[model samples]
Target: MAWLDKLKALFNFELNAPLINITKNSGNSNLGKEYVNSGEKIDILFDNLSKEKQEKLKLILKEKVEEGSKLLEEKSFGLLRELINFQRTKGEDKKVLDFFQNLIPKEDFEALESSLYLRRRFQEKRDVSKLKEDIRTRFGDRGKNISNLCTAGYFENFLMPLFNSSKEGFDNIYNVVVSRSPMAIFVHSAMGEDQITRDIKTGLEVSKKYGIKFLHIHGIGDQNIRTIKRCIYENKELFNYYDKEIFENNGIIIVELIL
Candidate 1:
């Protein structure tokens, strides 16, 4: 208890913090195994530090926070690329292309327009009509199938609102908050695997222990949306993250998208 109290002080955590339980029940147990520790290791490490070391660590953390703020300001064009590519494969209607163009940086939007002109010029020499149609068919079928399951809508309705809203709005929105949705797209080398796993596990455990549900979405594979929907509708409890009441009563679903 004293160690935990020291932990609360060291990490600036509130007293009586809820414990989160993360169980690996998906084919992606590797994803689930990532979330077993809840920063107890950090607490232990901090506990072993001398008073001088603790103060030094605090200064380091403060510095990192300032650095992270700067990094967040760097303009991210990844989403723009994804949207534009999706539109291209799906056969862009002029209205949709215009909408997406409006969302990108002016330079990027211009580049896309130039690329389209080049594509049209090359179209005369190559018989890519079939190839283009194939791409549209494959992606369109996949998109429509996933959309039917309403997993995107589920996240948008239940999970996204939490992130999109202020802290106070999140707290006030639900009487019994069920789960959290974490997209593990950071499996890339940019961030450490261990760190991402630990963060996910800790977040899920804490949320669940406090009666908030945590749902993890693996952002790597072809999302089997229909299967996930069946599992939810049938009350199958296929994964370790399952909360029966939440799935049964509210038609709550979880699906991962490439984007």
Candidate 2:
């Protein structure tokens, strides 16, 4: 009976192996082929099976992929924690801490941090009345909805320009909103620089020239926080020099949203 149980577990493990492979080799060139092959094989194997059996396999695959993604995210968080340990005393450390705090369970903190980041980065004083009006009109009274709408507009107008210089501009922005309290979001353009450094430099330059404040929401994922923080801290001089207009305008604030 023990041997049978062990064999059953192994069979279940084999059934879920594709998801582990996908997570481990997400960006590999062969990933597309693997996905295609897996789907095709499943289709072929289930061709004569009952409809319920086919549906079960499909659901299983879906669940595995979702579980694998969660695992990847947890791994990423672990890496970020490791990176934080190395930069114990930097202001970036505080920023990272504040960012996570807002992201964990505090929706209000997330909203406030997001608002302050935008206000500081744009060097534009947020007219709370105007913002409130806009929020009411566009998103009603829900804080998450308001944050999503505002952040989307903010990324499109400010960050998108830095990445795409053509008069026509970028294609579209894709955003993933994580937590509300620390109000975290990730923005990506299909056409922007592959490297984060290049993207930051471009953003910094544009912000400096226009006297705009460039509010960075946070790093891509947990793994990136340390590197992103270190880069920003090390290049403080360059950031300040380019953003002199922001300084002149008194547009520097690292938001600590307490909610």
Per-model TM-score versus the true fold: 0.22, 0.23
| lDDT score of residue 72 within candidate 1 | 24
Model 2 residue 239 CA deviation in Å: 3.3
Model 2: lDDT equals 0.38
Mind giving the per-residue lDDT tens digits that candidate 1 earns over 188-256?
Answer: 223344444464565556555544444443222223333344344453334334432222223223333
Error of 2 at 138 (Å): 25
Best by TM-score: 2
Residue 147, candidate 2: how far off, in angstroms?
13
Every candidate's CA RMSD: 24.3, 17.9
lDDT of 1 at 186: 20
Give the range of the ten consecutive residues with the poorest summed lDDT in model 1.
142-151
- Global fold similarity of model 2 (TM-score): 0.23
Could you say which candidate leads in lDDT?
2
